[model samples]
Target: MSESPSTRHPRELATAADPAWVDAFVVELRLLGVPGDEIGEHLVVLDTHLRESGEAVDEAFGDPREYARSLAPGGGPAAAVDRSTVAMAVLALVGVVLVPAALGAVLDGTRVTVTLGGVLAAVLLGGALAGLVLPGAPLLALLVRRRWVSFLLAPALVALGAGLVLLLPQVLVRVPAPLVLGAGAAAVLAGSVLLARAPADLVTAPGERASGGGGRLLGLLVLPVFALVACVPVLLVRLLG
Candidate 1:
């Protein structure tokens, strides 16, 4: 006699316990342009089925993205982009780029010297390059489980920004404070604008979400905390030297 369907898929018993998989499924469905109410209904049904049957997601309905696509035909790779995703990306990028710059400026004050100006230019260039290469480094880092990369990115931005602030006083003739601050703010704003206009598909992935609340809070705090710790050494050097 053939084994029963549920008995045949004993491995699927674990599916009901894993909420991440369901979250990912809902995300993909949202990306495919499924209405919010419809998505919620689908999730409720799936959750009910999983609870009752104790089947692995793949065993019951196949891969989440594929399953969603099957249900919503034509909601494939070419689906219309969600504006909220783009807006979130823009806000995140702006925050990552501008926050550190603003902090650094506050620390450095208005005194500008030639050496400081040169350092500022180099740091700005480096930031520009990072923006070009990483584009949405902070947000991307948050989505994926690349802990080391994520940890490093925000600190690096802060360090560069702080370094620029430290150097700002060395120049004999300082650029106006307003210009420096304005430029940093404007650059980040422009970056946000560009990101907002990028193809939706490129900006957000199906099933992509920010990490948990604790992780996000930590991600935001890391830069400032690092900046504070880093300043200790700089302060000591200034005092001792």
Candidate 2:
């Protein structure tokens, strides 16, 4: 009698829980273009059904190729691409609009400096999308693919945004009050736009790779407070220096 995929090797699951296998499944799912929500739902279903059936973790996830086939059927990769473009577009919008606008307000110098930064961030964002996303179009074509890649992408953006947040105090402390307010305005605005375009699948959907549920909202609320609090350090730095 063959052991199930989940239970195939208890010893393996005991150590790393088969990170490579899970990652491969996630990568394949992304290639198929399943909606993030649906992917999460299916994973839950797979996990539950497999567990109930007495399958081990590794065994349970063994048939992701089959699951992927079941999802696409005759539609193939082209179908997946069509489904992905909208979300992709939204992502592009976040890069094109939000990033530059926020940076513009903060880094205003002569009109030249402001315009240049705006242009640079926008161009870089566009390039990142094209480089990271477009080439993978076939794989990313699915309606709701929930891959670690997609999930991880958001935080990378957030991390970039966070850098700006941390930088604001240093910049503001040295600048005039009007410039400080402008920087704050820009930071807040850019942050908001990034939040608005944040992919729901990445954060909200279960079984998808997410840092936390409600985390974006929590960040939304917390960032401003943190920014305000950061003023103390900025003031101190200025007063002392």
Candidate 3:
């Protein structure tokens, strides 16, 4: 982010003398994966310094982004984000790949068909989506951050592989349909529970959650959405069969 001079606020802003600098600093820290609470404490320190020194923020702090980096270079207490991202990836994998196989079995009176290419496609697509949600992963994250074509192209490539899995004769193993369905449903339920305990859901009070209402709404819909995904294949199978 570019550095710019900003006027100092007098006492009312509560965090820092320069609102612009303070905003940039907070944003940079969040992008670095610093936890929300820790960022608040850091702001208090900056405000205290500014009050004592009576100096222009730009003169004293140099640049907000640089200062934030110096304070939180490795990022503070974001294991939650990383863990949530992994849970999301697992949910994606089981929900997409296993459900379709189970559907194939129940609808066609066959065991759940599996292929090497299908598994790889599921993993890559799942990982890529997870990496987009939380940065710092290799390849996918870099591609997204840089606006590289991988962000646009990865899903298309995975789709191509999925189409080939249906067309080509490459059976890896056939899992019992009922067993696959049971296991996939259980895993998805477990992952949803973990997601419910994620940092976003840990926000204190109904009012605070309302502040991020869209995210909170999505969190509320998780169970129903998961149920819908599980039921979709069954509906498709019945309709098409």
Top lDDT hit: 3
Query: How do the candidates rank by TM-score, highest first?
Result: 3, 1, 2
Q: By summed lDDT, which 10 consecutive residues of candidate 3 come out lowest?
A: 201-210
Over 80-165, each residue of candidate 2 has an lDDT whose tens digit, in order, gives 33424444344434433433333333444423123333344445556555544553463243323556666776677657655544
Tens digits of per-residue lDDT, candidate 3, 1-241, equal: 2133223221233444677677677666766666554565576666678889988788988887788778885533332347666776577567655665676687778898778767766666665666656554444435634566766676777677767667655888888999987777776676666665564422121112213435545654685476667677677867887
Runs off by more than 4 Å, candidate 3: 1-28, 42-67, 73-88, 126-135, 138-144, 147-151, 163-168, 201-220, 223-241
Cα lDDT, model 3, residue 8:
28
Q: What TM-score, computed on C-alpha atoms, does each candidate reach?
A: 0.41, 0.38, 0.60
lDDT of model 3 at position 32: 65
- Top TM-score model: 3
The candidate 1 region of ten consecutive residues with least summed lDDT is 2-11
* Colliding residue pairs in candidate 3: none
Q: How close is candidate 1 to the true structure, as a TM-score?
A: 0.41
Question: lDDT of each structure?
Answer: 0.50, 0.47, 0.62
